[model samples]
Target: MNRLSLVAVAAAVFALPALPAAAQSNEITIGISISTTGPAAALGVPERNALDFVPKEIAGVPLKVIVLDDGGDPTNATTNARRFVTESKADVILGSSTTPPTIAVSNVASEAGIPHLALAPFPLTPERAKWSVVLPQPVPIMGKVIYEHMKAHNVKTVGYIGYSDSYGDLWFNDFKKQAEPMALTLVDEERFARPDTSVAGQVLKLVAANPDAVLVGASGTAAALPQTSLRDRGYKGLIYQTHGAASMDFIRIAGPAAEGVIMASGPVMNPEGQADSALTKKPGLALDTAYEAKYGPNTRSQFAGHSYDAFEVLKRVIPVALKTAKPGTPEFREAIRQAFMSEHEIAATQGVYNWTEKDRSGLDDRSRILLTVKNGKYVPAM
Candidate 1:
C-alpha cells in the first residue's frame, strides 16, 4: 500500500509502544502490508493513502496501525504477517495490495487465527475463510458482469491475456466458467509476468485469433501492456479489462489506447452512476470526497476505496468483538474473526457486504459496475 498522511496517522505510527503487556491490552493494533513499490505500486499507494483518514479509535479503544511494505512479493508479505503476529500482536491484518501477496497474508492470518481484511480478492481455502474476509468483489461476481456485458454487446468469441500468476489464472478460469454458459468461446489465451515490459508475443497471438473481444485479466499500471500493445499491433476488436485495471493510472499510462476499453470494476469509482436510493451511494460518495480532498479531483481509485472500507468493516466488527473479549489477546483475535463471519449487511464505500462462515466474500453483483475510458476518464458503460 502507498500513503501520504494526516498528523493523526503519523502519530499513530509513532504510537506503537514497546509491547508492554498492559499497554497492548489498552490499545487495538492493526497490521497492514501493502506494495508501496514494485509493479503494483500504482494500486498499493492509494490503498496506503486511504488509511490516513481512518478513525483514531475502535470500540472506544485507542487504535494503533502499523504498515509494512511488501514490495509486491509474497515472501515479503509473509514476513510482514509473521511480524504482526509475533511482534505487534495485531488484533487484525489488513492487506498486501495485490493477489499473490494477499494469498500469502491470508494463509499466515489463518494459521495464526487472526482476522484478516484482505484488500485484494484472492481465492480462499476453508481454513483461510475462517480467519479472513475479502474487500473487493470476488472473481465470479465481477466476471458475471463482464460476461453479461459481452452478451449484451453481441460478442461471440473472446481472447485472453493476463498475468501469469494466480490473478490471471483466477480470471481466465472464471471466464471459462461463465463464457460457456453465456455461449461465448475462448478463442485463444496468453500470459505475461507482472514486471514484464513487453507482451509482444502474447499480443501477437491474441491479435491473430481475431476474436470479437480480448479480455485482459490483469491489474494496475502493468495492465496497460496488453492494452497499448494490442492497439499498436493493429488489433481492432473490443478490449475488456478486469477490475484490476480500473484505476485512473491505467488510463493515463495506456493513453489513447485506454479509450473505449470495457472494464469490470467496483461501484466505488462512479457512485453517481449508481441508482438513487442505492445503499452504497452515500458512503461511496463520502469516500470520494474525503479521498479527493487530499489526492486531488479525478484521482480517486477503486483500490483506495477498498482500503477506506477497512474502517467501515471495523466500525461494525470491533464493537461486537469488544463485548466478548479484550484487545491484544488470542481470544480477541478469534472474536474479531467471529464478528467478520457473523456481520450482517454492511454498506461500505465499495458495496453491501453480508458475510457468513462458509463464504468470506459476501458481495453480490451490486458490487460490480461496467465502465469505459473516455476523454481520459472512466464513465459508466451501458
Candidate 2:
C-alpha cells in the first residue's frame, strides 16, 4: 500500500504542468508615480494610457502595476516613491513623469535598493546612477539639435521663458551651454510657475527685449502658456520647445499659437522619416502602431513612448533576473538593477539603450530629431 501510494503521488506531481517560480509568487509589482493631475498632466495622461500596452504576463509571470499621481510635485513624488518601496514592495519603480519628480523618486529608489526607470530626462548624477535609468534623452544631446536649428535660422539673440522648477533650470542650463558655443546670445530669462494663469508679465518683458527667437523650457500643456502669451503680445519670432512638450495635448491646448513651433524630439514622433535600419525605427513603429490602435489614429506621443520604453526595459531585464533569483526577494531586485547597468544596445521606442555604470540615461544625439508643428501636426524638420 505505501509503495503504490508514493508512486501515484509522484506520478501525479510529474504529470502536472510546471509553473515558473514567478507564478508561485503570484505577480511582479511595478510601482509608478506620474504627474496625472497638475501641469504635467498632458504628459502623464498619455504615459498612463501606454501602460495598458505592457503585457500582463511575461514568461508565465503576471505583472501588477501600481500607478500613483504626484501632481507634478517633487514632495508628492517622494511620498509616492516611499509608499511604492515600503508598502507595495515594488520590484521596480517607473515614473514621476517630469524631471523634478523623477529625481525625487530616484532618490527613494536608490535608498531602497530598487531599480528606477524614469520617464523624464534625468541628468544622471553619480549618486542616482547607482539604481536609476531614464527613458528620455538627456538635455545636452537634444539641446544640440535645437542649437543647430537656431544657428541655421540666424537666431543671434534668444529669450528664455520656463517653469520656475527643476525642469526649466535643467533645460535653461543646457541651452546656455550649447548657445554659448554657437555664439547665440541669451537676451532675457523669465520664470513662471506651471499653474500660473498669466505669463503675460513675462511675455511683455521678453518682447521688450526683442530677441531673435525664444525657447520655452516647459513641458506638457503648461509649456503652451508662454507661447500663447507671446503670440498675443505680438512677438513675431521663432519659437522652440524642448522634447517635454512633444504631445498632441500641447497642440490642442496651444491651438494656432503652437503652429510653427519647433521641438527636439525622438524619431518615433515622425516614424516615416526614420531610416529602415536605424535602431529606433522598428521599435518606434511598433509603439506607434500599438498606441494609435488603442488611443486613435495618429495619436502617438513621445511621452507615451517613454512609458512604453520603461516597460520594454523591464521586459528585457526581468527574465534575466528570474534566471538568477526569485521575485519578491532582495536578490531579484539587485539582479534587475544590475541587468540595467549591464544592458547593451537594447532597442526601444525612443532609441537604442546601452546603459553603463557611468551613463544611466543611455541615449546619444541619434535619439533626437528636429520637428515642427505644421498644419496642426508634427512634421520632420530635418
Candidate 3:
C-alpha cells in the first residue's frame, strides 16, 4: 500500500505543469529601439547610456534590455518594433529620435497594445496620441518659444530652413503657425536633405526675401548648414534656431559661422533649471555627468538631455509593470502605458516631467531657455 500510494503521488506530481514563476522571480524585458548609428546617433548614444544606467540605480527584480539599432531609418524602426513585441516579448519600448521612426514604431507598438516612450520632438496629435508619449518638449511648442524670443529681440519677419522630412516639416509648420499669432511673417521657407553639405542656394532665397531673422529646424548635424550658408551668403539678420538644433555638434560643424545664432532651448541654469523641465531633472544631471566623465568633455549635448529622459521613463515603468503582471499579461503592458501618461513628477536634470493625457509632450513652455552662440561657444542669451 505504501509503495503503490508513493508511486501514484510521484506520478501525479510529475504529470502536473509547474506553476508559473511569481512576478518577483520573473525577469522584466524592456525593448530599446534607438539610432545607435546614423545622424541622430549623437543623441541616441547618450540615450542608450541612460537605459544602461537605470537598472543599476533601481534595485528590485532582474531586468533585461533588448536593444535594436533603428539605423536612423524609418523602415528599420518598424521592423525593430515588430521584433521587440513578437520576438523579444518586451513589455515596454523606448526610443527613436525623430518623427518618422517614432511614428512608424508607434503604429506597431500601439497595435500590439505595447506602450511606447517616444523620445522624439514631434508632438502627439489627437490622431497619434492614443498609445505613445514623448519625453522631450513637443515640436509645435518650439515655434512659440522661438517667436517669443524673436519678439523680445524686436524681430518681426523670419526665414525658415528645415530638413525635407516629417520631423522638420512638423517643426516648420508649427513655427509658421506660432509666428502668425505673434504678427511674425515667414519671409522665406527652405528645405534640405540629411548629410547635405550646403544650403547656399536656399540661403540666397532667404536673403532675397529680406527676413529680419532666420529660423533653423532639424535634428543632428544638419543644423550647421543654416548657419554656414547664411554667413556665406552675406546675410546679417539675426538667426533663430529650434531647440532641437541646439547641439554641440552644430557648433562644431558651423564653427565661427554659428556665432550670433540664437536657439530656443530648455533651461540650463545649473541643475536648478531642471526643476520644471521635463527632460532635464535629476537623472538628467546624472546622465550628463556620467557621459562627460566617460566620453570626455562636451559629451552631453542638448539633444542628449531629451534622450536620457526617454530611457529613464522606460526604466521606471517596466519594472513596475513586470512586478504587477506576468510577461504575456495585458495588464503588464497597460501599466507601462499608464506609467508614462499618468506620471505626475519625474525627477531629471532637465526638469520635472509632468506627463498627462492631454499633453504627451513632457516639457512645458515655461522651461524654454534661450541659448546663443558666442565666440564659437554656446552661451546663455543676454
How badly does each model clash, as a count of residue pairs? 4, 1, 14
Lowest summed lDDT window (length 10), candidate 3: 1-10
**Cα lDDT of model 2 by residue, 73-173, tens digit:** 88888888877666667788988798888988898888777889988976667778888888898888888889899999888999999988888999899
- List the candidate 2 regions with Cα displacement exceeding 4 Å: 1-26
Candidate scoring better on TM-score of 1 and 3: 1
Candidate 1 per-residue C-alpha lDDT over 1-382 given as tens digits, one digit per residue, 9 for 90 to 100: 2222222111112122233343238888889989888999998899888886778887668787888888899888887887787777888898879999999999888877788999998988898888889999899998988888889989999999999999999999998787877899999999999999999999889988999999999999999999999999999989999988888899889999998999988888999888888888988898888888988988889898898899898999999999998998887888888888678888887888889887788888788889998898898897
TM-score of each: 0.93, 0.91, 0.86
For 89-158, candidate 3 gives per-residue lDDT tens digits of 7666776877678887787777777777776765465656777777666766666767777899899898
How should the candidates be ordered by lDDT, best one leading?
1, 2, 3
Give Cα-based local distance difference scores for all models.
0.86, 0.83, 0.68
lDDT of 2 at 83: 74
Error of 2 at 309 (Å): 0.4
Tell me, by lDDT, which candidate is best.
1
